[model samples]
Target: MARPKNQEQRRQALIAAALDSAGSKGLRSLSLADVAKRAGLTRGAVLYYYEDLDALLVEAHKAGIQRFCDRRDTLVQSLDSPGDQLAAAIRAGLPSGPDDALMRLLYEFDVLAGQSAVHDELVEAMYTRQLAIYTSVLEAGTASGDFAPVLDIETLAMNLVALEDAYGLHIVAGNSHITVDKAEQAMRAASTGLGAPPTPDGGETPPA
Candidate 1:
């Protein structure tokens, strides 16, 4: 007999299916039945996990954020210097593979957020959380002397966050035109723009 799926597995399956369906088409067009069909489960099963479309969407957005955060944490773990950690985290924020789809979902949220006051507040909170995460790393680097003392860490952090957001938009416009390698190079240059010198080994990559 086949093994029955666990609750966590089902949740993950639903999240994946929802993202897949919503990412390709705008969330405005997404329906529970669409996600159910994509996930290979009945609508009743989907509704059992998510009471309604709004509930499912909120859960999907949270899952996407959590997934991105997990990836960011894994990439920055056990790093010696704060500068390296900040650079690594910047790279982590970029849309990669499935992460691209998640980001597309975020863009959808941004649209919906414009229409509803509640969503606007939620998006603002999410934005602040992201800025705090990036800025904290920069402040740590400054404190440790890994980055120059004169650097404006807060301004730079915010700029990097904005840059990454724009870069994702460019990629979504046409993946063929934008490459992560180029984005990394641009980020490295931007990092150095704030009076922080590039690592000793060549000028492009931040020292590992």
Candidate 2:
């Protein structure tokens, strides 16, 4: 048995193992044995930490959300300009590639939404958090006179989140149709044309 002091570490390790295992096998097909194999522990050892695979995955999903949204928001807040914040937020929200297990699991969570009430809540919470990022940035830019958005702040924020989710889906799905750079460029372009061009360095000022 893991000592009380190591319980949190053990749980975090299992969460990582579960994400890795499910990354390849997928959420619907994942099993406790799969996680155990990835973690090099017995199924019983895994059960010691989690009631079941679903319980473990619920925590894994929350961890993934925390890492994704929290890091992005923190980075956004670190930047002084709303343009820099918006640009940084968009870039931070994407997958590294098809092999990005974390992003893959996030999409899987969407598929699992109907399987349980907890999943439904996580999915909705993720969407809300994503929307809030853009909304907050856009509102700040508008208030500071940094952005002269073409659309209402709410509409613009919704469109940006939609683009990120859509492009991120394709990027993780391994579509040759779009690469990360293309997605980022397209999103930044959409942002610029929509009235919120990132004005830090690479961003163009919106049309007069």
Candidates' lDDT values, in order? 0.73, 0.88
Q: Pick the candidate with the highest lDDT.
A: 2
Predicted candidate 1 versus true structure: per-residue lDDT over 114-165, tens digit per residue: 7767677667766776687777777776777767735577777778788877
Candidate 2's residue-wise lDDT over 120-152, tens digit each? 999999999999999999999999998999889
Total clashing pairs for each candidate: 0, 0
Model 2 spans > 4 angstroms off = 200-208
Q: Which stretches of model 1 miss by more than 4 angstroms? A: 1-9, 97-99, 149-151, 175-177, 197-208
**Whole-model lDDT for model 1 versus the true structure?**
0.73
For candidate 1, the per-residue lDDT at 127 reads 73
Candidate of highest TM-score = 2
Q: Enumerate residue pairs that collide in model 1.
A: none
